[model samples]
Target: MFTPILAISASLNDSQRIHALKVGANDFINKPFIEAELAARIKNMLLTQQLYQQIAMQKEALEKMAMTDQLTGLYNRHFLMPYVEKALSSAQRYNYPLSIVMIDLDKFKLINDDLGHDAGDKLLCGIAHILENNCRSEDAAIRLGGDEFLVVLPHCSLEQAKFKTETLRQAITELPPASHKTSASFGLSSTEEGNFIFEQLFSMADSAAYQAKMNGGNDICH
Candidate 1:
């Protein structure tokens, strides 16, 4: 992708020189050129190329920072909608199951109230790591604001989602004790028909998660 091409050619018309530059010629040298001038042109081109590459890398890093959650290093809620919409459209068109798991930390407020926000933040970050480590590479682990997270599992069924949630729940329980013990509740929802919209999918998962919280603090509902 990064080919450093320096084209040395004989004399060219104005239009031809413009075309060469447009098509990515690093430097074009005319015949009977002075050695010093040619060397200077090549050096300038190399410096320009380096500047361009560094600017490109900086731009890429800035974009990634914008899309990521600073606390957990996971994709933030802002990045989830567009990605989920695209995935849902594909699953619906192909008739494949797509599941969304909604998770909430149990008694998260109590931890903040008792210990401090720093402790609560650490617990949230720990939970984010568990979610990231447990899910497949293709899945998206998203932090949906404080204490709430969502995992989008493409081509996964309700049963599979249940299994995954259980695994995560167990992992949360096993974390070393902090200021306060941490547990999580999960709600799993899947698309069966081809017409379920993204909002409906979210609603199903959100409702289930609320039910899990009502029943107890650490459980899963679907």
Candidate 2:
């Protein structure tokens, strides 16, 4: 709440008025204050408060834009570290499992080259939608730049993560014809494997995704 304080004192002096302002008073009204003047000051204070609230809201919106991927509307890499740190801390404290899945679009370059960048973008957005739909409310889906994506699953076991990743892969495969037969490789890592470090978990998942790509895309490995 934006609270504006107006200090009114009948015996207030110059020094007292200064002190009141220094102690958080928005404005001070001395003795024999005119009703009209006081009303005008209150209106001005309310307007100032409204301006402050607008600035705060805009600041929040800008921060969200900084953290979000412009194309897919998913979280960007800039949001990854802090979110992972907080999630890992909570998982460690609660003794719950946390899993990470890395996804890489297969033949994305071919899609761009053959169908054009617009088509490729559409495919990417479609996959992003699949990731969002398959994840729980507590999970976070991030676009890690270009055609790479990551999903953070809290309180999920390794097996559960693998299953979820497979579901995402199948959904991508079955996308509408407009998506142009796009597919992705998925890799998974979990805290149940005794690794709580974010970098380590991410590396393992990334390696598994690479392996899936090596075996040909549209596969899940980990």
TM-score of each: 0.90, 0.96
The collision pairs in model 2 are none
Q: Stretches of candidate 2 above 4 Å error?
A: 177-179
Clashes of 1: 0
Best by lDDT: 2
lDDT of 1 by residue, 13-40 (tens): 7888889889988668788789999888
Q: How close is candidate 1 to the true structure, as a TM-score?
A: 0.90
Error of 2 at 29 (Å): 0.7
- lDDT of model 2 at residue 147? 93
For residues 1-222, could you state the per-residue lDDT of candidate 2 as single tens digits? 678999999988889989999999999898698999999999999999999999999999999999999999999989999999999999998999999999999888988998888888888888888888888999999999899999999999999998888789888887644646678999999999678899999999999999999999898989
| Alpha-carbon RMSD of each model | 2.1, 1.4
Clash counts for all predictions: 0, 0
lDDT score, residue 111, model 2? 82
